[model samples]
Target: MVTGTLDRKQERIIAGIPPVSDFSGIYFYTINNKSNHELVMLLDSIIGLNDSVLSDWLNITPRTYRNYKQNTDVVLKGNVKEHIVLLLSLYKHGVEVFGNTADFEHWLTEKNRLLDNEAPYSFLTTVSGIKFIDNRLTALEYGENV
Candidate 1:
């Protein structure tokens, strides 16, 4: 295991909630390192998915999710960390495509007729789902009416 402390800058970058447009470099780096539970909390604050739902997305029981939150330095498993990063990236893309975070967040929760009245939020449980959403965002970005 790679054991070390994250300097304030590194923590700031990782905990920046929805990452900015040039976040791919940092995203790639974070994928290989373990993340603190605070990342999860920050993500929750922005997405506002309750722990129960978020825990399910993380593929862990609610109890384990709570346990993770208790430890500030807890290192999330690789898959969990990757899922978080991808979610962040998806949100970042959403914000960019929609021109604001609020609209993007609204779009995530609101059911879309194009998607057969299913809220895009329902697909956030897996990495493929995140990618699928990202692709949809790309379509919107190009004015393809997705």
Candidate 2:
């Protein structure tokens, strides 16, 4: 597997998240109850990565990389920021993973194993663990207020 280096800040971010992806109640447990730190732990778990791989990705020392992660917990939890960081983590390793990316729907449709017509809705909803867009959802054009 390919490994990279990270500055201290990046290392801290990866070190922050827990490594579990099977939890069905990740969001409800974190957001509704303000357990953002718990979510940070989960993001850190992605691909079982380390500071070295991340350092190379960031082109900095491990120290700086880790510091950013320690502070980026909240943004990581909201799926607003730190996504590229997360993606870079996986991408550098040649691993495929998912987040709240805008391409989520399309990616799920084409690659994610569908449970036989139970989807375009339920599957994604379940995978995302969010109930915002019910059954009647459609992909919006770019910048169309998704």
Candidate 3:
């Protein structure tokens, strides 16, 4: 869960409509049939990733990715849903650490020597990669430089 005054763009990264009164409230990452738009927004708008790249990450064809965008009622399941959840979790942690979205995005794209000179964002295409990045984020959250 996360708490913050998210703008419209930030809202796109979330799985559901946040509480109106408490702008800064915890957000749980649970995507379902109804939240397909959110996933699309996260990948296209927030992450600035193209459909082809996103499709590749999800191990789906570009045509399927297009279908997902065109069909509002499309429901994501299995590994694709799991991967989106992982990405949202990583973004949440990055925001917490950087205190802003831009800085976090920069950090994500910047090569890190600790990660064997690979940009953190480059490791987001696999489950193992997600775990590795999450571990690094946790370490940073706990004041570990690495």
- Compare the candidates by TM-score and give the number of the best one: 1
For each candidate, the alpha-carbon lDDT, in order, equals 0.69, 0.36, 0.66
Question: What is the C-alpha lDDT profile of model 3 across 1-146, one tens digit per residue?
Answer: 23345466556556353321222332233433346655665555555557776777677898988887788887887568667666666666666777766787788788989888988878888867866777787788899875
Tell me, by lDDT, which candidate is best.
1
lDDT of 2 by residue, 1-146 (tens): 11244445545544443222323333333334343443334334443446654443334466754664576454333442233333323222222222333344343334323334443323321223222222122222222223
Q: Which portions of model 1 show Cα errors greater than 4 Å?
A: 1-28
What value of lDDT does candidate 3 attain over all alpha carbons? Answer: 0.66
Task: Please tell me which model should have the higher TM-score, number 1 or number 2.
Answer: 1
Lowest summed-lDDT stretch of 10 residues in model 3? 18-27
The CA lDDT at 100 in model 3 is 69
Sort all candidates by TM-score, best to worst: 1, 3, 2
List model 1 lDDT by residue over 28-100, tens digit each.
Answer: 6566445567566656655555788778777899888888778788888777877777776676678668776
- The lDDT ranking, best first, is 1, 3, 2
TM-score for each model: 0.73, 0.26, 0.70
Candidate 2 structure, TM-score to reference: 0.26
**Which ten contiguous residues of candidate 1 have the minimum total lDDT?**
1-10
| Decoy 3 TM-score against native | 0.70
